[model samples]
Target: MSGQRDRGGYHRQRPPTPSSSAPNMSAADPSNVPDAASARSAVTDTSELVEARRAKLSAWRSQGIEPYGKRVEGLVGLAEARARFDAEVQAAYDEAVAAAKASSSSESVDDPRDRVRVAGRVMQHRDLGKLVFLSLRDHTGDLQATISKALVPADAFELAKRLDYGDIVVCEGPIGATRRGETCVWADRIELACKSLFPPPEKWHGLVDPEHRSRRRYLDLHVNPDSMRTFTARSRTISRIRRFMEDRGFLEVETPMMQPIAGGAAARPFTTHHNALDLELFMRVAPELYLKRLLVGGMPKVFEINRNFRNEGVDRSHNPEFTALEAYEAFGDSGTMMELTESLVHRLAVASAEDRRGEDRVRTGDEDGPILPFGDLDIDYRRPFDRITYEDLFERGAGFSCREIDRVRARAREIGIDEAKLDDWFVVNEVFEHDAEPCIDPARPTFVVDWPSAISPLTRAHADRPEIADRWDIFIGGMEVGPAYTELNDPDVQLERFEAQLRDGGDDEERTFRSLDRDFIDALRVGMPPAGGLGLGIDRLVMLLTDRASIRDVILFPLLRPASEAGVE
Candidate 1:
């Protein structure tokens, strides 16, 4: 990939054309780069933010103040800052400050300002003669800080006045309340924490541009407190999941992300070359096969919570890469995995409700799940999630069970499934999606079980019912969150499934890696214990738990195009 100049003056990797850059437009007029002329021309650009910060930085520097500050550790969180507030203490303190100013002869006097140290990005600042008010924000939350000239040293008070919003500042102050009862730290000592060279996003709307927010999430996180909370909740949710899995005795393990064959799922791989080894490697689409292999290797139980790369489209729900958790147990079957998935998701929902404030969880942002609002519907992740077989759901949705081939085909035609041309399974999936999928309560984390054997290549078929595979997909908020599979330990059966998949037009590239899982079979031939496996979409889970509508929101650095940035030659 070659680097191309983006609109943000950042280098974005583009198709390898040539190292040559787009001719420097700035060479014609360096002064135009940050001038009002350029700014008005592209007011949409974040450079407007940069320019604003530059002006503020200049003003502060002219006043002999550093726009960027020094190292100041031991910053207290907003929640902690709020804890220091005391109504009675603050009233007395305010009186003390008033008296100190009025009593010129008063030599020694008691001051009631709360003495505490905290550091944060300056979000809001107001200086009123002998007093200053500021809003300090950190990952935990935000609070107001007040500095009175009479309380802080003369130099410190001056520093407080010179402080610009977005600058990092550390202040030692007494915790008290403003007359309005807003919790505030009364500053006695102030120090520069760190200088922000760039201007912040719109203080009111913050970083509202989706593209910019994704590109410079660090800026978004600081500017938008809600963004920080979303990410923080995502982390805590993952942490809780790990604890849940571990408590259930699932041993976590790392697997080879680079594989000779990306055979586990029907998704494109991110291919890369190992120059030294001269071997092609693929970013795994799923850790399913490896985790299953671990079960075969006598690991008894194993799980991998990691990433899977799917070279696919970008949408509200899709990303090129995303996190997943895949687990396998030696003696469990699909039913076991089903139970585990349900309990896990239920626990997550309960925990999220507990962690969130207001009605976001209980009311739901979406109408699909429980009463807990999802996008618009309250997603109900409550226990005993709805369960319906593929046939049952299809029958209800298509007005005929999947077994009613003729009607299924007719419905498919009506739905543009082209049943007359495609494979039986393809047509089945088509109607299943448009029709059957809608039958499940999107608000309920429901599982549609027993997929058609053709689509579930790796899943085992019910002995009594070879037409239906022992598999299930769990859906919530109109998205498939994960799937569960009963183990197929018979090598001969496994080989048959693989061969049938190839015969179905999965060409050479796929066969090379999908080739009969001989080693897996060998393990099965060793009389391995039957097991159930589960693969979960961790990012999507985070999105649900954090109430982020798009998969991109929960993701830290979703891939994006670098905006064209102009610069001086």
Candidate 2:
């Protein structure tokens, strides 16, 4: 249950056998040594290159050159440095070399290999004995650096020969083309930015094992560069969401996670005891009640994007602690929330693929296109998503209207519902979820509105029909993205709803936390505004926008079976 374990911050490289190295392992010792501060790493079973690099750290310190490095100014990214390489400048240098080679009588022009500074983690360093091809990576991207025997001072050139794969280094080089026309930096000066003893992941395969990858995401991100891109896109999506809400004057706020009672949704809660108070507190199941309190306090518009904990199942779509974006608007109801939900989602989808011109998942081409792939399916966020009523969808699925009690009861019995022992609404909900839910179109986002009044306890009854509630759930790619509600503001009705929930039980799990939500009803009694509320699962949205499948994929540190990972099943 503890998530404090290291998530692969260190990947130690295995050592090459002494039999494969020079005849005497100690004979090739260079003066580049580590300081007392940067002592030889504690892990003994590391690669020969890693141990050699450690020796260099101690050797460098002996010569007053700190192997770990210091704060040197003027560091540009490796990608930015690579972008500065001009074909004309390289061509001119080639002409100068040609002229000098043609006749010793001709005056040679200045060689393009000169001073320029860059910094990055040493991603790859293949020792060719006479030549070194080192790939360095920063946040921007990875770029190759070439070190040749003829291009550097003898001592510095030898340092390049022994550079380890994970060391961070700052190189002063001139960018140019290789013999095959691949762009690279030819460095005349190289200094240790930071010495890394860790062994990187497999060069070509990257991080493939899910458990290893999740546990060591840093290595995964570095090894598989595309992983970072997914997280980066996640950040962009959240930013766009915030901007969309803020631009519409919605105030963002925070709420309590540890509460006396978990009141927002029907689910089991993680219970803990407050030592001082000797009182039981449950981790927040939702921010609904608290968000509604803000509506009572006269904040006309508000939203919160935060985590909620539930002591329940962990699956591809559900995590113990998940992020949710909930918003409330005064003087609004389900209709208002519907409009806001559509606009917010559509804008985010449009913004997500706005930079893409092609019909692919990754952004490319026109930068104004609307195609973002989600698991082999390219979702079009060009316009408003499809909308349908809950009854209509259920009717389409069950082959009869939900209002026909006889058909509903018959279908429920066939679908494994024990009708003789179940309440009408519960049976109906079970049937709807089991049958109608599958009818949703997987590609187009759809909202199923006007739920039965019995199931939607927190929502207001429909203005046109008292038997139905003003609630709607937005489904995209066969997943529930969000739900909107025209809230019940009357204190008496709110209290009645909460009390009624306690009277009706779904199963043991729901019974554990489905008590009368007194505090929320109390807030309602204090004159809460008639409001529209919306709850969006931010992590799921990020997963949708980024095309990540598991809820754990988007979460930085997801809950996992213990590393002693035995019988999780």
Name the best candidate (by TM-score): 2
Worst 10 residues of 1 by lDDT: 1-10
Residue 384 Cα positional deviation in candidate 2, in Å, after optimal superposition: 1.9
Hey, what RMSD does candidate 2 come out at? 7.6
Instruction: Give one digit per residue, the lDDT tens place, for model 2 in 81-184.
Output: 88888889899889888888888756746876545688887878888887888898888788888888887888777778777777888888889878878788
Error of 2 at 334 (Å): 1.9
What lDDT would each prediction earn against the true structure?
0.77, 0.78
What's the distance in Å from true for residue 103, model 1?
7.7
Summarize candidate 1's per-residue lDDT along 255-309 as a digit string, tens digits: 8889877767877788888999999888888887777777767888888889899
Local distance difference test, candidate 1: 0.77
**Which parts of model 2 have CA positions greater than 4 angstroms off?**
1-53, 103-108, 111-116, 355-369, 506-514, 565-569
